[model samples]
Target: MTATVAIDSYFTPVPDEIEAIDLVVEGALPPELNGRYLRNGPNPKPGAPPAHPFVEPGMVHGVRLKDGAALWYRNRWVRTSLFTESATRVRPDGSLDLAACHANTHVIEHAGRTFALVESGLPYELSLDLDTVGPCDFQGRLTTAMTAHPKADPVTGDLHFFGYGVRPPFLTYHRLSASGELVQSVPVEVPGPTMMHDFAITEDYLVWMDLPVVFERTELGVPYRWSDSYGARLGLMPRKGGPVRWFEIEPCYVFHVGNARQDAAGRVVLDAVRYDRATFRNEWDLAAGKEKTGSVPGQMLHRWTLDPRTGVRSEQQLDDWSLEFPTLNENLVGLQNRFLYLVGGGSVVKFDTVNGERGVHRLPDGAKPGEAVFVPAENARAEDDGWLLTIVSNRIAGTADLLVLDATDVAARPVATVHLPRWVPSGFHGSWVPESVVR
Candidate 1:
């Protein structure tokens, strides 16, 4: 018999759904930090190893905070149609049911509703308490899958996102009004089925990454592989959704975008963590438990400036350190922001975009912190005037801590550390829903 694959640190699913009440807090919790911090990630069934991390079913882990206290911690698997059915189900047309998605990539709140999102299917709505509500199709308007990384304009409250598939009409842009109505869905022309994980939005334009990572037909895991023949390009389309102008760039893959905005000269500036073709493929294979040869290059914080009028593009690396899961203050989305928060290199780093300096909150040896979620202070005045919440797992101690750091001074010690009952595996994107928004 084939030996069972050993579970990686991230693929170790919790044995049971757990709830720990009245968690011990080490430091003082910020009074304004009132609400829930929910993060979604893949957690496969026990003894059922998935072909890849991305295909595992989604489980959401969350922590509730109010009145400067850690109220409770809870985790639940998102119940999609895929999780409920016993037999293999497919549509009559041969297309997989998008509603049956794992809903594992991200957890976000918009228009008073919380949604767990995966790029391959419709979003699964969850209750404020982190319980799965059901799959939401935006009142039957969203025919295509919703992106995991949807940007909500801080000024207009409008949500902007897009979805890509393996077939023709491969990409489509979506817009939702502040009131939660699906206002528009426009089909965008692209060359082929590229794995467009995340995009960016500036004040006047929406940026699209059409890299060389193309989807191929395979019987096993995710069928995406790096293609040299498929060129790398970026598409700039007006915010109002019109014609798109494309510009070629050096081949690279960006899993997440820090922020984007237009400079004084009307050039579009974009910041993200970039991985080269070889690094991207090797990492992909490593995540799938496949052996790879050669050293794996790290993802660097990179920037690109595009001048639409002259069709000139400039690229540069912002830092030498490796990082991923970059986030900025939501209030500064689509606008000029001075700081970017990221997780990698065994710590949570605050990058000063303006001064090119960095502040880091390094985890203890043998501990790893997940993506840092920024919780803005009530009536905040400055961009970094908030708290950064992240789940730190101590592999040696077999425990985890909900770490809260002052956004303004991340390098200092954590303001509060909530001791968790169990260790939580590293996961994807999360959101901090204020109490007012929950109500």
Candidate 2:
């Protein structure tokens, strides 16, 4: 038998939560940026054995900014059933507890309410001060797990997302109103169960990636694995409800979508990072603390254009940089977006679709940065007229800092830097909730 190696210390979690006020700041923080930057990720409790990266409990780190000052920095666990009770979702009657979630994937605010979300369970409500308010099922209307990558339509204010399980009704599409009411739930038909991490959106449709990664039952627990026979496809579901139109695309996996849009000609274009079979397996094994079999290729930006009228699909490689955690201005969620941001090779990369230029902001030595979240400037005119917010952690010094850079020129010096009081483990996704939105 082969022994598994230990998880990488690249992102070590701090044992306890802490808070600090009036943190030291470098450079000028935009006074207009009066909000909180909250991030969530996997963090096992102290003395807990290392488990699969995704199985760890969820923790959120937040930094508040107001009137050009870094007001406070706080980190808190979601206090889910997993955290507080060490409970299992499986009941004695074999029913599943949808609320027994780690709530570790992302944090966002909608309709004056904030939620900590995971892909496999109900979203956990959170207070403005980062306290857990308990599990929320939209007043008993939500019967399915919610996707952490929900997209709020800037024009209509509808939140679009989906959930997948191993049983019947594998994939279900859902939508929430601007006031945070559950309005629509439709079962989406897929040939088989696959790991659908994220999806995309356009003006008139929602883009779905049915890739090669399929679910498999393992001895320990059921997990998704790459399958050559499962095939690959991209489907288009109308917002008003109708039959889905799926297009055949090359077999690949996309964990994140940068942005997507549809033209008047019924042509849809999606930009995201693609990983082949070997690359994904390498990543999967690494997260499991297993030895790599061979060289692991990097993830690159790929563009897919599907034309429904002619039943044709064209694809291209957009960039060679290894990337992840793609993000853009939320206001342009389903619209034509010119600027997209991602992090790779210890830098924040900004891509301009019109000019075909890549702007990069490389971090200092030994400092690793998380996703570069785009926050649009007040009364912003240009697509890149915003700030790029990220948490930069130094593995060597056991420290973390909040970095704010000008979106127009990512390679430029940061607009502000807030020195955090504790070492924040690298996290998944978060939101920049303006004070007005949550108030």
Candidate 3:
């Protein structure tokens, strides 16, 4: 059986529609190209798409979006000559320029009037705004592929990014000024060379979840697969800046980023989904006469809390079925209260983060959800009192659309649906930004 579920519903592409922006949605290294000798060879499975496509790229790697407008990253380039915008690419200064950027599993944002973290290095703050998409050093070496979902401190306005240190795979944090300068850089120990994914931060601490270890071999054997032998840890790195500490978990239970909040008891609460491996085995060496096989558990969704001062923590598993991804929406109902949301096999759930209470609603048959955003309710008194924006692709139709849900009563029908002109490939992650803050 496949590790990840198949895409049940996918939307159709519009061949004649004018394509505006392109983003990097998912990544993978196909089997034929990942072996010890051959870097990129012919497909091992003829006519079948590789497990990972981001490792090898096609032309037109990056997508450009203007202020307040967001685009989905399609692993493949969507080309169109028809236009509301110019077909010939131009620089931020309106000069004729042709450049392609390959940004897989990284954050792309326009903030503080001008600046962008395009490639996975120091974020280059620009002098121009969204209209002036400035030049970026496309060839810069990355210490670690920058993870998406960067958080800006509400108190200090400092943007924090989590990355892997290249020479050796250690987790590192880079703080950027509002002006886009790399103000500080610090290294944190994460036991293994965690992949470019699986790291997060809150007001007081940086959180690194169970990440995959990159072996000495250059080949990444499986797409989006983590080890069953190495134990996964819930690690914490202080924002004030200090040593990294890890809390262990049974290996094979993978973690994904959700909403994080501090509780009244001085503990930080994280909502993460953990999945069990499909296979497991313990092997014994004849000479050593010892046994060692990593344990892979069944799928579980859990809420974990950790105290930095005392290093104490607790965990509570929620759903019996799989809970793939969970996101926290603060102040959706009100700034004082917060809600936790997640997408599973065929449903979306909204729960009270403080308590464990929640509401569940299923989606239309065959609709695969991408990232989500919280839009304020149309009016204060409306049912559910908030809007949940999700991008779902329909399998039969082969088309993707924006689905607006009622957060208060998620089971309630969709309030609005924005149909896009083409299919949007699945994306790893994304977040929302208010229009007022764009300028």
lDDT, candidate 2, 290-320, per-residue tens: 7888777888888999886787889998887
Candidate 3 whole-model C-alpha lDDT, 0 to 1 = 0.47
lDDT of 1 by residue, 1-439 (tens): 1112333464567766878899999999998888899989888777775568787789999999999999999999998888767324358788757787788899999999999999888899998777889988888898788889999999899999998887778999999999899999999999888888899998999999999989985544576888989988888999875698889999998889999999999999999999998879778877777788687778889999999899999999999888889988988888999999999857999999887899998887768888898888778889999999998876666677899999999989999999887867778889888878864
lDDT of 3 by residue, 1-439 (tens): 0013334323122222134333222222111111010001011112433333332111111222222233432222211111113334335786432223223333334344322332223333222122223333223433343444466654566667766543444666677666555566676665666554555666667776754443343333222334656666788777777777777655544445655666677677776665544422121121112244455343556667888778887787765655555665533211123566777656777766556676876777766775455545434563246666666656645665556576877876665554544555444344334434544
**Residue 159 displacement (Å), model 2:** 0.6
* Cα-based RMSD of candidate 2: 3.9
Error of 3 at 317 (Å): 0.8
> How much does candidate 3 score in TM-score?
0.66
TM-score-based ranking, best first? 2, 1, 3
What lDDT does each candidate get?
Answer: 0.86, 0.87, 0.47
Which regions of candidate 3 are displaced past 4 Å? Answer: 1-17, 20-101, 106-144, 210-213, 216-225, 252-255, 279-299, 330-337, 377-385
